[model samples]
Target: MRVLLRAVKQIYRQPLCNAASRKRSIASSSEGSGLLQPRHEKLIFCSTAELFQELGGNVEVRTEFISEEEESAFMKELEQGLRKKRYEFDHWDDAIHGYRETERDRWGAMCTGVLERLRTVAFPKGSTLLGPVHVLDLDKAGYIKPHIDSVKFCGSTIAGLSLLSDSIMRLVKEDDAAQWLDLLLPRRSLYILRDQARYEFTHEILRDEDSVFDGERVPRQRRISVICRNLPS
Candidate 1:
């Protein structure tokens, strides 16, 4: 019982609403329905960057991590490298549409150099880079559904370099759907997710019409993300 109470207190520290203290994972009634009651999923869009930091610095972003010149060169290589690969709309679980993904253990000289720089900010000294690096292309109308990175595929840290266009990435707490955050990923920005932010949050790319930040509609277009992960734990 003491252990359970401690767990409840920890959740309480993370704000929900005015009645946050009264919130319980499973609603109960005097009549004792016994069956778990359904709780409405209330998406609270966190417009500020501070909320992300509240997660013990598990999520971070470095804007303009790469310059325009580097971005252009990387984009050119990505397009050229995957020119022949087919973009598949029908994912096995329908998680992504109008997307093409490929992995490469090695990149061209320019890309290799830029990624080396990315490592300094994204990982600790001597952290192993899981290969081949993942390159995903999303069409102008494409979007990725909410899902967690499989522990089987990668370890805790996953860093993505955004290119081509800007978009919103939403992260929802797996245990509490009402708790969520929307991140504006501009072109040339690098976003990193690790530990709790990487495992506990289900990340998704918002559809174009649904992309909004701080009450302003943020337009999304054909975008690509160069994803790098560490070896599985």
Candidate 2:
């Protein structure tokens, strides 16, 4: 049981004090040869506040999206429900491993509040939301291969609340992989992908060994993302 709480406990302990200290001005992907030029300078930490502007307003993040109590509660519910589950492989994409997922028609009041807030900020007033929320649990060693969500399943805007661990998500142009940007997704942050970000780019969680940010190594740990999508147009 204690092991289950190990990752969630990081929420109350480690503050993101280093976020500003490691901040850097990244030129637009078009300015330089690539967003991550030189390969050695692959990790760049952009401020979440300016991520919308930095990433052409297609991608946005809201840090501190959930309170500590809410996170703790979510951890408890998920750990118990998913502990006995085994990792499943997708026949379409082999890059994903060590992961389990489930869909929920509805969540508790506590989650409802979070979802409300997400829609309030990430979507326009009275936007239609998909009823089934997707919960994906990825092990510390797990990694998601770069792929775009099929338009048949969901709509344009995709909102995800990241929990448990800090991670780096890379969004690369599907046609040109060299043109890419890295997003530092700290625990409890809400990331919203819409329009170009959702359609033109393939999103993937980097492997543990590749989790670097601004010349520093950022460790990847167990993470669970509560994902919500808008109705298909």
Q: Model 2, residue 97: displacement in angstroms?
A: 1.1
lDDT of all the models against the reference?
Answer: 0.67, 0.66
Cα error, candidate 1, residue 214 (Å): 1.8
Q: For every candidate structure, what is the RMSD over all alpha carbons to the true structure, in angstroms?
A: 13.6, 11.0
- State how far residue 37 of model 2 sits from its true place (Å): 25
Alpha carbon lDDT at 194, candidate 2: 88
lDDT of 1: 0.67
Report the Cα lDDT for residue 6, model 2. 9
TM-score of 2: 0.75
Residue pairs clashing, model 2: 43-214
